[model samples]
Target: MNQVNVFLRQRKDHRRWVALFLALACVVAYATLDRLKYNGQALNHKQMALVCTAHGLVAHEHNDDCYDEDGELRCPLPELELHEHDDSCYEEMAALVCNELESDGHIHDASCYERVRDEEPSCGIENDTHEHSDACYGWHEELICDIPEGEGAHHHGLGCYEIQMALACGLPEITEEHVHTDDCFVEIDMTPDEVEELVEERGPRRTPSWPPCAARTRWSIPPS
Candidate 1:
């Protein structure tokens, strides 16, 4: 009887040990599954971040792609097409007007007019004490010895006379029959040939075109 009781106690202890081991295994499996789930979520978020960065969609505010989707953000590649040249792309150019030098109906010279001199007469006597004689008589009142105080007079022999000098001539005056020279021509801007050459070299002026892929959009998988 005691042997049977001991056998029964041993069987109960073994069953308890088996239950504890099974419980420990279940706990470990649950914890491992939870860690794997968390890691998977983190990896998915990192991959989405990389995709957004590659497509230049990191800034959500400035991009229209961020709001095009129904409930999530989507990034798409740009579509492009080659555009040919057209006349509408260029602005209208006006015809060029060139100016040239021409004669202004005038002439220049170094000698066109002559100079003139004036003269006056005085008594031919030598001493200031000589009295009025026939040489000083019958002359103009201005040529007489009675000179004004500030009349710029000097005594020559027995007379007082005013001497005047002439000034040197300056630039010549214009005449009625003047001839045109290179100096008489008016200055001008660019010539017509020069303007034509510039136009040929520059070809045509063009207005700026719209950017590539500016009018289109595409769709892709929404980021998690």
Candidate 2:
């Protein structure tokens, strides 16, 4: 009877040891799985930091945050911030920065200046302020009459007229029958020398016997 009791006690002790060993194994397995999970998360964060660094951004390890050079946060996507500018000036890109600068009232570049100049109003003539006549055309900064070149066009004050009127006023031969008047002349700033030079260059100057009015009338309705 004493031997049997000792055997039973030994069996009970072995079963207890087996249960303890199984419990220890389960605890070790749980700890190992938890450690692996932590290591995977750390590796993912490291990869994100490396990606941010490659895109010229600052990466924070504590919170895995990324920021641009201007201190603006651009986490999870640094590429989107690459083309953005802080001062609204897109110098790197080949896009027009005119609208942005104009809205902010900032100085413009060469291209923007040209765009503004092209958008200005113009009347075909530079600095033209006066009304133009039907027979005149815009010439540089002045409105000039479209008088035929060889038909005796001469400048008088700020106008152009036929050469016959100029000759009738006071030239080589003064006709007693023809009298000079403002109606027969076009106001201009032309000199006698300039008229003479023009005449020499374009054939000879024509001389008229009648006054400018009579000549105009005769030329308009030929003698029947």
- Highest TM-score among the candidates is held by which one? 1
lDDT of 2 by residue, 1-224 (tens): 99999999999999999999999999999999999987765554322111221222322132214442344333432121122223323122222212121122233344332211223334554455765443244333322334433443322221221222111222122222222223333333334455446446857323223222222111111112
Give the residue spans of candidate 2 off by over 4 A. Answer: 47-224
Residue 137 error, candidate 2, Å: 71
Give Cα-based local distance difference scores for all models.
0.39, 0.37
How many pairs of residues collide in each model? 0, 6
| Cα TM-score of candidate 2 | 0.23
**Global lDDT of model 1:** 0.39
Q: Estimate each model's TM-score.
A: 0.26, 0.23
Q: Write the per-residue lDDT of candidate 1 for residues 1-224, one digit (tens) a residue.
A: 99999999999999999999999999999999999987775554321111232222111222343322243333322222233333333332222122222233323232332332223224566577976555554442232223333343322221222222222122112112222234333333434455357547866543223323311122122222
Candidate 1, position 162, lDDT: 22
Cα RMSD (angstroms) for every candidate in the order listed: 33.2, 42.9
